[model samples]
Target: MNTGAVVRLTEATGVGRAVVGGKAAVLAELSVAGFAVPAGFVVTGAAPDDPELGGWMAEEAARLGGPRFAVRSSAAAEDLPDASYAGLYETRLDVPADRLAAAVRECFAAADSPRVADYRRNRGGDAAAMAVLVQVMVDAVAAGVAFTAHPLTGDRRQTVVTATQGFGEALVSGQAIGEEWLSTGHRATLSRRGPARVLTARQAEEVADLARLVAERYDGPQDVEWAIDRDGRLWLLQARPMTALPPPVSWAVPGPGLWMRNFRLGEWLPEPGTPLFATWLLPLLEAGYLDGMQATVGVRVPFRWTLVNGWYYNAPPVPSAALLVRVLRDGRRRAVTILFHALVQVGRDPAAADRAVLSALDRQWREQELPRYRRLVTVAAAEDPAADPRRLAEIVDQLGRHAGIALWYLAIVGGSAWKMEACLTRFARRHLAEVLPDADGGAQILLRGLSGAAPAFDAHAVLSADWYHPVAAELPTITAVTQSGDDRQSALAVARTAAEQRCAAALADRPRRLAQFETLLRVTQRYTVIREQQARTFTLAWPVLRRCARRLGQHLAEIGAISAIDDVFFCTRPELDTTATTDHAALTSAVAERREQWERQRRIAAPLTLGHPPRLIGDVIERTVQRARPAGTTAEHGSEVIVGHPASAGQATGPVRIITDPRDFPTFAGGDVLVARATAPAWTPLFARAAAVVTDGGTLAAHASLVAREYGIPAVVGTGNATSRLHSGQRVTVNGTDGTVTVHP
Candidate 1:
């Protein structure tokens, strides 16, 4: 194989990976593709260990104008997608021109070291064929690795860049804890640890773009190594398909107090909130929450909504000495009573202590909160922004203020449904575990649909699908699976009947127990239906709000305040509200900047709880309210299994269709297991076609759960990493009965 003396960096682009090896081949290809690469050459013939090699190599180094060089082994088997034999071979950095041959020999020798031999054998490689690369060493100011996709969430839309001062080796070799940035093409979000930064925002974004471009050409995500010289010029060092990307690790709380995402705020707005939603609506929503708490709970609950990594997280007020004092001062015995229930309650069913307060809240929602919200939404929805363009700002302002408060009421009512569910599950599990199989299904029987009938929906009007998805969402087809009059709507319906019959027969001898069970079942059933209905009703003004913003956006675009109509989502309410006198140029730049930041934030997974994790007191309140813990909400899981709450029963095996955005709705095929972070009302149409359902965030009371059971498909919810762990077209067996998903190769 001694066909050449050496291959120059540019000329090596025409050489094969077999000759120049993986690292060298990629660098050469990068140079050919017009990417900035340091001047280099690869020594290609097999006799790298020849004793007299140093003299000629030093002469060649001098010819290339190098005072120092970086010599690394580029084995044919190195940097492979299946097995990146990284660090198994030697890399000699800062080799003086006179030491080129020694560095090359060292790299060549390391290729046959015991570790490399073992790696190649384990990964089923033929014997190593090594090429040694010597490149002009970069006088790096900062250098590091960049992943074209978010390694944590497997979100390809995000690029993760890490850097440290001086050499790339310090970061890659685990010698330095440096700066980290997440980029979404247009934005670079640096993790600030100290006062100084290795790369500026613009420089980090350039690094991200470099990685993204390489991935685009290669048609897959790339693990790119890069360096920035003292001159601030970026250079591509090496690139290869990423291998064994790690699962999520850090979910440290992003804020303070008791924070959570997959509950009140996360229930619908599961993904990171857009800039407009975060900046304008979320704060207003928080204010409304405070209002609703005052109305429903009789004292203002310390509540706030925060945007962490662009995801909406709610910080529920923690009960405290101060809160107790405030509640006593306000003369709201209702707040004190609930706090007493949370603090003093200890029983087989902790939620039982709060039943009275819970009932009061339900009534408040029905009589006071729901009506006010309904009235507000009606007025907001009635205003036609198109016909009255002048009133767009007014409509937008009113919606932002009222919509948040309206949804807060929805949460208040829906929260009762969640508690009733826990109470019902606890009662069933304790008393009827033998007869009922599981508390979830036992509870499901009494809670499946509105008591006697499913509420009819005009499917077309529901999603207003023409705007988001190419195909309009459809309604689930009705089916009967019974003999004569007991015709079951689904397998679940049959199971529900069987469970109900078992419960009835089991408690027949005890009239008191039967009566109690019946009462609990009725309330749980009623709230279950109402929760879904309220969720739908509260968002009625969304179309109005979005349309008004867009109308404002059209005018903004016409006046050159933003680049596109959709960019309106990136503008703050203040900017849009004062449009006539606003600095349009400044607004345009702010919108563009916000658009990038939102994109970057959206790619990273938001922590479920931000700040110190809840302690004993918080646990007690949560346990009483939510007894059945949401499963698999941690960082670790089996290689091929995803665990979550079994929202619906009946197993099915099918290909996955993960819908992160509503635009992906059209790609869903019938019988595919629909996966998502969470589903909103607009997402319900996908249920008509999904074979089974899975969600990264949601509970048994979520849209996916209710709709899947309605559609007679299996569903699992609250597997925190389902969307990241599974990809589209991957086959999976969803055991909704056991709440386990098995990924197939």
Candidate 2:
């Protein structure tokens, strides 16, 4: 095998990896396959010390008709299936022809660089043979890297492209930020961490097309480097097998069963959930719902739930024997069983179920739970964790139990409320169309009328005070109850006036069904108020749990089980349980690994449902949510509108204030349209000052919805990406009645 020291990349036939190296071989193959690779030649390790290499370089440069050349390292170990020596070796670009030989030597020398050596060692590879690839430099207007499959989440249907202006070096070296484009096919969606876009939609799709071609040719997903020259010709700079491809994802097609996401428990848990929390919390929740169903319906239906990309999702339950028998007897029963299991579980009477659940909650609140929770809150506040760790743990346990009970009722409340609303909407639309033409309008009127009776309004007023500025701390001991009383009275007065006016208009001229309408109104108000009260009460456990977790975190940090107190969040419950009393190096490593995983998960757009997330511009629903602008408009200009469920009935246009973390609460200004992943009860205070609200996750019965309705502000919930799509200072008009948010340029 007397292969020459130098080989023309286009004519490098039968060149082995050991000679031409992995990258040069791939380029050679691509060039042969007719890809738009810049004309280049490879200089093997045999030529690294050859004095005549300079003559060869000049000939190649002249043949390519370029004064500047790119000298890139193509080590044998580079771009391996298991490892990508990306940015570990030297790549010298825009080198004058006179310095091409020196650049080649520099590229060859990169094989011995400490970083490359360490990288290879880590991957269990021996020293790599160096081959330098010299190509005519393409003066790029834009350059970037693209993956045929989504680099994260491993969705093969999507292509992820990241590009920046001028050169790829800036993006590769992390010196400058770049715009990201996700291309599914012909359509491309553009997103930016910073405010500049380097590639247009057409350009992005073109780049993605080239990448897909490379991947198809290679017979697997490819990580491709691409550039567009000043004349607008797309060029493939390099291509390599994608390393560490995510395991194949099996997406479930939408089916007949009930698929729940961004509703009930989903709204409260906005981030990618920690494993420990998911392990303990999800099962308990499932059990609670199961118990409720068993108690009400006398049959056990599986209430299975799972986390997809860290978001809670309830999987469609397996049909029970009773359900199957019912289906055989009546087709309508099957539809009802699949769609409205909550109603079926509660004897198929939503109003009765509402009454039963609300009555039980009222009794519990009055007899035992409310007083016990209040006393515990006082004890938790008064006794410092540092002074009494045992007592602190005991209080945390008690708080958890209280929260669990509340959650059980919340499950009932959420299900019953949804069923009740569905029934009410159906009845109003069918029977009361002449009296209340808009079913939603009729429901809104009833909700508003019931608002005056809600204790949640009083809680909101009390929470709005300065003492509650830091909600994470234990509630302050009220030295004087008069201020809260006066605020409550004022709130009640305002609510009562609004309710009376709204109810009068709703009931005006409905003489035939007056009594029935009034009965419906009373039931709707009672359940709606109870829903709000239970949700608020359930959240009280969160601050306590958070504090307990922090304390545990501190203990771990003091004992050197983890590096920091907050790192405890990254550990699994089992890991925490075992490592709490013992110090282990693996625990630290695991925490660090989990932190990285969490950071990556943050970048992923979790699918709205477990199976197949809606794809917009080739990316999953999660990734596209932030980048989604109104259709048929560019980011700089367009009348892009986002549609969601209208939770509150009003309309307002204002600058958006994107709040991802509660710590940013202080920065919220009066009248700013609040945008977040989701809002909890702790977020109630912001609603008071917000002109409108938009969220990526929530339902008509979500905390944000209830609060927004009470505040009489426009709110659109479950926009699925409002937090990611809308930026602070951008003006958006939120129409709660229409459930649409139109972004203004």
Candidate 3:
């Protein structure tokens, strides 16, 4: 135990990593810190040809009381922040004291081995600057590695341990499978139980504690190797920095209430949402609802409207009563000021506020926004407009403005529709459950009665036509008016019967309440129609914009600014703007690089909540209305049963048809269960042919839910990963009322 060419592991402090190497430095540090490390000596410098090395080994053997020792390569580059040589280096185990010098020489010579050279070349490391560590090897009862954090999930709160019997080298070298355990605080759970349990619960906790300590000392996660001797004594063999940890996620909830992804917005944004869409377009839509609440109730409720993982999340605002009170007071004062102004200007125009709301709803998009869009399209369709950069710039400006107008109105209609739907749902839950029995049935009855009044019904009819297509310049009209009229009459008759049967008892018992409910229901229907109209109108603009983008893309391709026309989507708006003046080679390279990055992003699942979703609190009406089912509904007993919100009520079993794009529609056969990431208005036509509907994102008021209710197909929405989980042609049973999809093996 002396400081020489070979220093005792415990006494080797202040020795630089370049001399004793990264592994020796860590071991020495652990020994100095009073961790249970084995007696060892580090042979510093190059190959251990020194005559003193043999004498030092003999002295170490006498102090440790054993001839057997493990000689390990500890290169300067090993266990560094960027490089963990790991199994790439040599380890000669159970070397006799006489062969210790030869073992050290062999360990050093491993630096020049072909495999080590290849590994260094691949990992971009220098040739190993050799040092050899000789230690009194433990005869292990159980041995393995532990991580202070969940490596894959990057969950810092948990420690993961992988253990197997015998040497940890077997597990590390992938020669043996191991049992896995995840520990947090005093709790430890076995994730994978191997043939034999390697460690007891208490032992696992002890290991986790030690690992956590090492990780803390290192100021990051640590990959620790440990051995539990037959006598139950724990020994630390190696500890190094964990490499390539995923970036730590900030798990703070956006607000005080749980934020969930809504399919209404998510369906429209099927791919990863772009910043422009999330920042510019989505906020405008969210503001419409927030503003509407302020106008109607004198309460300016805030919303954390954001995109998480490219999906839209409806986050509740801060739960501050003082903030709410202040907003209410301001809203009330503003309302009083408006009322007084209206009285002064028009001598008590009582309906001024109503007129104002009506005006907002009735603004003529066709007269103002659509005309500009049309003009742009007309100009862009003409030959070689690249010569006129100013004209193109004007068209781009017009396109953005027009799209904004469309989005603004769409948000207004959508937000209003959601409010109305929530009201209806709340009323049904409070009053109509006893009479209707089935909430989905009741909704269908009400919806069918108002079918003639909903533009969505007409739109569905047009969409149902065999030749109908979304990108068509003009939507097809119902040419067979007589047949449509007959179909409507039949549907109305059925709807009337269903409604009468459901509402008769309620109406008889509470006539006034029934009348009030009827009025609300009618208003809800009107809002629903407006929502569908705005969605359809807004969608029409997409084809126009898409055409323009493609045109520009084609021009860029001609100038060699991109590999293909579709590559334009990979470029940001500003990058696309540069195409007007930037050099072709630079633009092309940028687009190609961006395309690669975009493809990589598409593969990652975006977290539903940026941080942990906020905890539920208070008696918020939104929470009550959004519940998919009554409390204490028993979960279906099956491993394959996927739970989701019951959007539409029915039961059906069919082969799954996973549709990510409309282009995949032809693959959908009748009686197939449609499994989609989300569904847009454009996807409505598929409902008519599908036996059941399952979506990754949506709520009761989402387009898929509404359409599913209309089609009377069983639907479970907001499954979060239905498209990924359910494979095409896999048979499954969907229970919409139970909100479960049982996959068949």
Assess every candidate by TM-score. Answer: 0.64, 0.70, 0.57
Q: State which candidate, 1 or 2, has the greater lDDT.
A: 1
Q: lDDT, candidate 3, residue 490?
A: 54
Candidate 3 clash pair list: 251-611
Error of model 2, residue 592, in angstroms: 5.7
Segments in model 1 whose C-alpha atoms lie over 4 Å from true places: 1-254, 337-364, 367-372, 386-390, 452-498, 618-636, 709-712
Query: After aligning candidate 2 to the native by TM-score, how far in Å is the CA of 282 from where it should be?
Result: 4.1
Residue-by-residue lDDT tens digits, candidate 1, 1-745: 1236577778886778888898998888888889998888889755564554555566668878978898988878888888888888899999998777767778877876898888878877788678988899999988999999777566777898888888889778876665677787579865422113577788889999999999999998899999999787999998999986644334556555676677765776666666666666666666766776676557776665666666767665664789778888774776777655433441323346437555566576678766776676567666654445568767656666665666665665554565566677778777877775542444556555344334333222233211212111222322211111222244445666666777899999999998888777766666666667766666555666666767777888887878898888887766776877888888888887777666556666565556654474453333432345333223224545787777776679999888875456566777889988777665665666677899887776677777666555788887876775566777889866667888775
- Supply candidate 3's per-residue lDDT for 693: 97
In terms of lDDT, the poorest run of 10 residues in model 2 is 460-469
Candidate 1, residue 38: Cα displacement in angstroms equals 19
RMSD of each predicted structure: 14.4, 8.3, 10.5
The best-first sequence of candidates by TM-score reads 2, 1, 3
Q: Which wins on TM-score, candidate 2 or candidate 3? A: 2
Write model 3 residue lDDT over 1-745, tens digit each, in one string.
5545777887777777788888998999999998999888888873355667677778777787766888898888988767787788789987888888788888877888888888889987667567889999898889999999777546788898888998888888888767777798757765544445578777888899999999889998999999998899999999998886665434455555556556334445545554334443345445544544454436555556655444456655655778657765776765445323322321122124224452344354435654665565456446224534345435544554554455555554343554555556556667787765453454444654344333242332222111112343233322211112234435744864666567756777898878767766666666565566666665443444444556666767777778887766555556666676877777668767655544444444444443443354643323433454554564453335787777777789999888764556666777899988667665665676688999877666667776676566788887766665556777889988768898775
- Give each model's whole-structure lDDT: 0.69, 0.67, 0.64
